[model samples]
Target: MSGMGSKMLELDDEDELKDFRACFVDDRSGVNYLDGNSLGRLSRAARDSIMTAIDQEWGVELIRGWEHWGELSFAIGDTLAAELLGAASGQVVVADSTSVNLYKVIMAAHSLVPDRRVLLADLNDFPTDRYILEGIAKANRMELRFIATAMDEPVVADDFAPYLDDDVAVVVLSQVNYRSGALNDLAQIAYTVHSVGAMLVGDLSHSVGAVPIALDDDDIDFAVGCTYKYLNGGPGSPAFLYARRRLQAELTQPIWGWFSARDQFTMAPGYEPVAGIGRFLVGTPPVLQLRALEGALTVVCEAGIERLRAKSLRQTELAIELFEQVLAPHGFRLASPRLGPERGGHVSFEHPHAQELTSILLRDHRVLVDYRAPNRVRFAPSPLYTSFAQVYEGIMALAKAVES
Candidate 1:
């Protein structure tokens, strides 16, 4: 092995989260998987939990399973709120997809300040988020504005200042940039948005389990995130929504399904929404997916988010170091923040041929990663399942792939 490879192995040996890697089912496909920011590895606990739910809960208990499963959404939400989001109970609920949750929260926030006619978001916001804003703006006859920012830079409070007028009702921003892996200052942006009486809606999809977030401390009004990425939840798992305790009473989501009905079981005569976070829920929760996430979260809660964040920072730092030393010579330029604290769980690089290179790395080099847009390749080192050695090998493989 090379000297650098030996150093990485040593770091892995001392890693505190080393034991947690065994909790996941490694396919042993010999691929250096660095796409955890896109989708996390499956955990053994999640598999067992799903099987148990299918055999015992569903087969044996059958329809009676509702007795225990009735409140599973809220129960799981509370766990996520406490462990992952740094939020209080009764403020968060697990339901719907990230896009759907964003719609609900953004619409609810807009209603709070109906007189305002403009909705604002980052110019490079995720495609789905931009689509949702466009739809909402057209339907409500409101103007939607974007805070323009370079692809490599994050949208900071300063960027939003010029657009924050009395007409701006809701300001939406992602806690972490999906493409650049840049971390935004949530507290500062929240303070800035609140200053103008505009509500701040945070999209936590890229930061949730991989980074430490204090929604309450930041005074963020509403937030949403997916569990399938850093949380190790299975594919198509429900996303979570957070509405501050103060906002729950006044806000109402567009969807008014039976699950959100005040008396869900009563088949109520009217469309009265339930009180608290339960009102955000639109339909019956996906029991099996929720179970998978619940089971997977046990590992995260046990390891703790602070610890996870520390390891994530170190791993990403290592990746950046390797990139500077090797990949830069091969035409890769750092697209993410150079400072670890300003970055999320991953590091991204820009190359003219990033898309084609990504395909070669996956098909030929067995280095799994994802490519974005015009030119970005993201390498996500999940602290729980990804080791320092994997991060080292993944970048090294990318360097070799470029050479060949």
Candidate 2:
């Protein structure tokens, strides 16, 4: 469609990750998928894993599967931590939805500082995160302070310095901005929050798997993230949370289900929470979905997170180049960070008719991208399976969509 397509083909031929495309189910015959930031494509490993979990684990083992199924949460979480998140083994656990985990962490943070009356957060965070924090603030009669951030720029640690005070109990921030694909400095923000006698809770939904995160090294008090997007854990897959080892003894979440009890099958009269990260669990684990995630994680582990991040940066660089050369002339402005490390895996553009343009791309050009409110179209080039050629074709189709 454009002369840049040949250059993309050359780049693809030289890519060490060219073979990774075969690892996932290639259902897009005539389409170019650019929405991995929203939901990743299904992988062949995940498909086989789900079938095995159902047919073999469930069908054959029956009740005995509980012996293994019960431990999948921590087991999978440990694997994620080792492979992706830079945290120790027992500090993380795969559990409820991101929203639910956020609720638990927010409540726990508030309990830690009962005297504090304010909870701070980013005004432009994901809607679900803001809703959970708002509910927590309303329930506890605490002041919810939102730090206003520029829509087109990234949120830096300096933005929160003025908002920090002794009255602030917790500061919640996303590692990567969902709308602009801007990466925030987690370590600096965490340090700033702790300086004010407040705890920091990070939302890693966009950054996990797309980039490297050192939760333990950063001294993050609490964190929560979904697996469906960058982790490629299928739709509605279980989320995970992290709590520092030192805080485990003091942190008590709102929900106290049997799974989080000291002895799950003891049926004790009083509830005694477990002493580790497992205490964050609320109820029964999703075995089928977890199996799918387990399988998906294998692919990520095999590919290695560092290598995947390198490819992600390169792919996004290509996308940005195309945006400047082609889409910029058509009234599209770069919404994501122009620099490589300052951005996440996705690239977003602000356009007047972004919503309509997204629909037209999908319906006519078979190029899939997601639209955010007002006017932003996001294109996530997942490193695990997305290719430079695909990125090239998607941008060409997007340019044609704008023209038509």
Candidate 3:
């Protein structure tokens, strides 16, 4: 475990998710990908499905495909919501980028609680969440509170307790922290936010496909996530937004387009929002991309999230063990929390030369991982396709890169 030469042969031998590894294209060639946190490997089902969608649907159906295309977002959302989101149908819809969905839901949520005027975010929250909060606050002249921000490093689930206050309109929390691979307690935070008369908005961009969640059971007011990460829905496969069924009536949809109207067939003049979650659709559904996502989602459903969670824990644990054995001697400090509840499917390590070292590892050793600002390399081990051998080898390369 401590040496750096070759461990993949044994590591891959022990991987339970090894059989499912063939499900993806692994376009890496000779490269070892440890960056599922950034972008997931292309699934075979997704690739084949997109091929058919592009050639057959766009080619043959032409302009007459609206009948089915119109409902693609909802259909995909229903499966994802029912199977993965721990919620019933009619609560989620696939549309726009995670940023856009955040904007939509935040806007709607603010309108619902007009009297409150503060938005709360943690120090380790993703950059996009921070940026979206800043923008939303600036546009509305509301205040953005970076709660538990200063003198803070690696804050855990209980760290949010001090920041729960009555003046906050909504608390935007990432279900999983981006750089450190830390996980948040969604239900507990949701309850906390509600206790102070504030709604909770969660970003599941890193949680949905890797772990399981129960929105309705948790009484979560709003949620949003991207498909291309853990969902393996190809690159930039749009995103999905969720609204509690009862709360849908309390907030007006901010996104406007013909596809989100009550009746698009008549081409009416009046602008009326479509009922329920459909009202959040900004434009025409990306039919081909949606099809590709649906295909990838089918694979996730087939594999199942519970099994995915268990396998992800094993792979990440393998990586962490390898790091402790190999990198601890060298100088790469473990930055991510070791406990299970405080982690997602990825791991993080800190080294002063992260930027240069990451580039070197990629160029000279064919290793792929992401570098956060300052000094951190994030390695995301996707449960469905990535193998333990890959993680073991990637860590060895990291150890060698930093030492030699």
- How well is each residue in 1-404 modelled by candidate 2, as lDDT tens digits? 45677878888898887787898996847678889988988999999999999999999999999988999999999998888989999988998899999999988887788899999999999999899888888887889999999855778778998988899999999999999999998999988899989999999999999999999898999999999997789999999998888988887689989999998788999999988888999899999999999999988889888898999999999889989888999999999999988898898999999999999999998888899988999999998878898888888888999999
Candidate 3 per-residue C-alpha lDDT over 1-404 given as tens digits, one digit per residue, 9 for 90 to 100: 54433456665677666787788875757888889878878889998998898888878998887768888999999998999998889999998899999999998888888989899888567888999999989988998888654211344446666766778898888888787777777888787778788988989998888888988988889999999998888788989999999988678877778878888678899988778888889887888889889888877888888888988887788778888888888888887778765678888888899888899889989999999988998888888878777778788889889876
Assess candidate 3 and give its lDDT. 0.83
C-alpha local distance difference test of each model: 0.90, 0.90, 0.83
Judged by lDDT against the true structure, how good is candidate 1? Answer: 0.90
Candidate 2 global CA lDDT score? 0.90
RMSD of each: 1.1, 1.1, 2.2
Q: Write the per-residue lDDT of candidate 1 for residues 62-117, one digit (tens) a residue.
A: 99999998788999999998988889999999999999999999999987998899
Clash number for candidate 2: 0
> Residue pairs in steric clash, candidate 1?
none
Q: Determine which window of 10 residues in candidate 3 has minimal summed lDDT.
A: 148-157
